[model samples]
Target: MTTSPLAASTVTADMVWIPGGTYLMGADDQYPEEAPAHPVTVPGFWIDRHPVTNRDFDDFVRATGYRTLAERTPERGAPGAAAALHVPGSAVFVAPDPSAGAHLDDLSRWWRYVPGADWRHPGGPGSSAAAIPDHPVVHLAWADVAAFAMLTGKHVPTEAEWEFAARGGLDGATYAWGEEFTADGVHLANTWQGEFPVENTAADGFVGTSPVGVFPPNGHGLYDMIGNVWEWTADWYAGHEPPRGCCAVRDPRGGHQAGSRDAAHPEDPVPRKVLKGGSHLCAPNYCRRYRPAARMPHAVDTSTSNLGFRCVVRPGHPAEGDRAATG
Candidate 1:
């Protein structure tokens, strides 16, 4: 594969070359969004070895003076603008009161829109990334990830590309590493250990986002592909159509913008993008979406404490050509 121009300049030592191939892109029996398991083939590309870290994002912000969506206050006149969304903040995972009995259906029981919960201040104003520089940078919306990608001459991976690399050549495996969630009673990924929201045993040695690369790498030598954080993808969130009997698709992109709106919040009109790999909040009793095939729809303008992204370098892209010209 021809190398991207940014590969030489911006591709850090933590980036790993994913030799791509065909794979079953979705799960047949899982969530409806990931159903109709289809075959998809993707070209080889380089992906970050782990989710973008606080240090990496800090460097980007320092160089470009960019502001994340969570750091910006929402305009009042926008369609479906709620009073609660007027202030600048991101959704933070707040543990529910153990005595009150956790409500699984009510997400508000555990999620709160803190006033100053951006990437730098993950838990609001007082919190800082100073102590967790190596942790994955969270609270990034789709536009924030896009800005970073443009600045670095990289692009966000499409759903197909992300899943292909995440599989690590293990076709139809339940997890990135294998069928088992753990081996010999050892946790593989940084998923929730106990009951959701109320209790966390931290069996994986972390209650929240752990430092990237603390866990074992997948077969492709990629870190945190399944958990630790939910990663942004280029694909717009749309349900997959069932494939024609036993046929594979070539480099399938996600749905169009018009169809990417969330059905539950149709009045809002903010388009949603696909988020993959689950997060530290995922648990067996709650969100069992830590698998490679799992996917979630996140609004483009809505950032959360568990959301972040990594960049990908595709071979012979026009963006790379543009970067080369400017350089």
Candidate 2:
């Protein structure tokens, strides 16, 4: 199914197509490394109904002026220790228990590590972008989303093409539009509804990041994917222990070096190569992972204001192909 010459062209905006097949990938009773539900497939591609904005990476830095490693500053073979990267930087999730006070462990207490906070100042100093220019541009890192999917030719969807476009085709049923994270409590996504390391009953309006397209958009339409932030697949995390128990399996490259996980899947801190999606402190009492086989393992240079990315379209569109998927 890899026939995309750009696939008859015309698809790019908001991104869609998905079309792949096979489902029921994991979740053997909810996170035993996402348990033996196997049977994946994948093939047809194209995804990004939302989740990569700041006006589309600010029009890819206004067309190829491209620079985001938090905005660079090291120069010539850089990798750390220029006074800890002089300036230009990222990673910001601070809230280890504000007035909400007590959000469980709060991912090592609200994931701080701020340098300059990329994605255009996401809470690093004053946090600007004309005041959140519609938000959803986060710090980014897997080498700055593989350098924005190789300068926007596109190439960041593979964890079986991001759970076959986040199970928009539906199969094993469980959230993403099935299961039931909320019947009366209300919250289809945008997690951590209550006391994690504190309290964040944002209820869905959102306590942080949340504007890319609002909600109610699966079945391939896309939107939030599962919650709010946590998408960066390209696979590089592995943690198998299947047969239906003992969590951490398939496309879970969260243990090679990135976001490190696999201490049976949750002590968070050992994953690498990036792969976050719908789980910004996800909570059903404590981390639901949002859905579509929820994953986490970011750190390919480490960047996150909750991380963000989206771009796909490869079936056939090469009259002069350049902006393969954008409005």
Candidate 3:
């Protein structure tokens, strides 16, 4: 076992040292994709205490003058491109009225590609990330995360690493904190209280992303590990095919890039990546994915309102010194 810096107080204020350990990577009870609950081990690494916020991302943008994927207009003749994909925009969740007879099957009823919907203007035209600077930054594609990670000398956590940290030393528990979604009648994370895509009660005091650290931290002092927003993982989207006769598959990445392509549309070979920690849009009636083991496959080119990311810095990484000196 690697010695944990967490005990030595070497952890930075903005990050937490997740001790290396073995844990069950997925859950068998919930969601078909996250099945065959298997054992995996990950090395200890430093993870952001919370999801990267708008203020944090804004600083990155200001420093590097980087433009997120959403800000760039799509090429005209791209394969499997939407008819209206010429504009620079990102997907935004606009809840329709319950009386409108919006079927849950058709996600288009709620999700619409809004022009000018980037990290700066999360809700399309009039809205601004400035209004919720403390909230986790949204409307980021995989490339955006890549750019941010590169600039900061950090890495996007792999699926195994992410799941391990999210578990917060809780080996096989269902949720991040515990088995109960709401422990002791207290809302632990920012999740949809009522029906999703139609009505949100804001019971957790938020309809969208809540300010990071507003909710209680998990066992590892990591906040928003379960909800607030879905976080990007480095691993590709694939089934949980753990190595047979496991010796605790160390740091198992998901499916390979070629196999991660969306099977639904074979014509478009755009690969999907794993997204963990279901977002604020998750609800009981819709997506009950606010659990630590829950996983979602997202296209690399797509950016949504409820998707964001955090980064990690493993020990012995070349950028480790740089991160410490800068942070």
lDDT of each: 0.83, 0.64, 0.83
TM-score of 1: 0.92
Clashing pairs in 3: none
lDDT of 1 by residue, 1-327 (tens): 233223335566778898868888899787877897888878888899999999988887876778987888767754322355688777898898899886788988988878778999998899998779999999987778877787677888888888988888899998999999999998889999888879999988999999999988898999999899999988888898666667678777788777788776787677888899999999989899999999988778788888888888887773442221111
List where candidate 2 sits over 4 angstroms from the true fold: 1-43, 46-69, 73-86, 98-113, 116-138, 141-147, 150-152, 155-164, 171-194, 197-229, 232-277, 285-305, 310-313, 319-327
Candidate 2 residue-wise lDDT, 1-327, digit = tens = 123233243456667787756666666777665655666655576777887778767776765566777777545334431354466766676665466566464465777656666776787877776576766788766666655665555666666567667768777777777777676766666766767646777877788877776667777778888777788776656653343454323333223344344444465453454364565567767777787876655545666677676766556533232221111
TM-score of 2: 0.34
lDDT of 2: 0.64
Q: Which stretches of candidate 1 lie over 4 Å from their true place?
A: 1-10, 77-85, 320-327
C-alpha TM-score for every candidate: 0.92, 0.34, 0.91
Pick by lDDT: 2 or 3, better one: 3
Per-candidate clashes, comma-separated: 0, 39, 0
**Candidate ranking (TM-score, best to worst):** 1, 3, 2
Clashes of 1: 0
- Give candidates' CA RMSD values in order: 4.4, 18.1, 5.8
Off by over 4 Å in 3: 1-12, 77-82, 263-267, 320-327
- Tens digits of per-residue lDDT for model 3, 1-327: 112212233334699888898888888888888898988988899999999999988887776678887888777755323456588888899988799864789888898888889999999999999999999999998878866776676778888989889888888998889888887788999999876777788988999889999999999999999889999988888888866783878877677777786655666677888899998999898899998889988888899999999988888764332221111
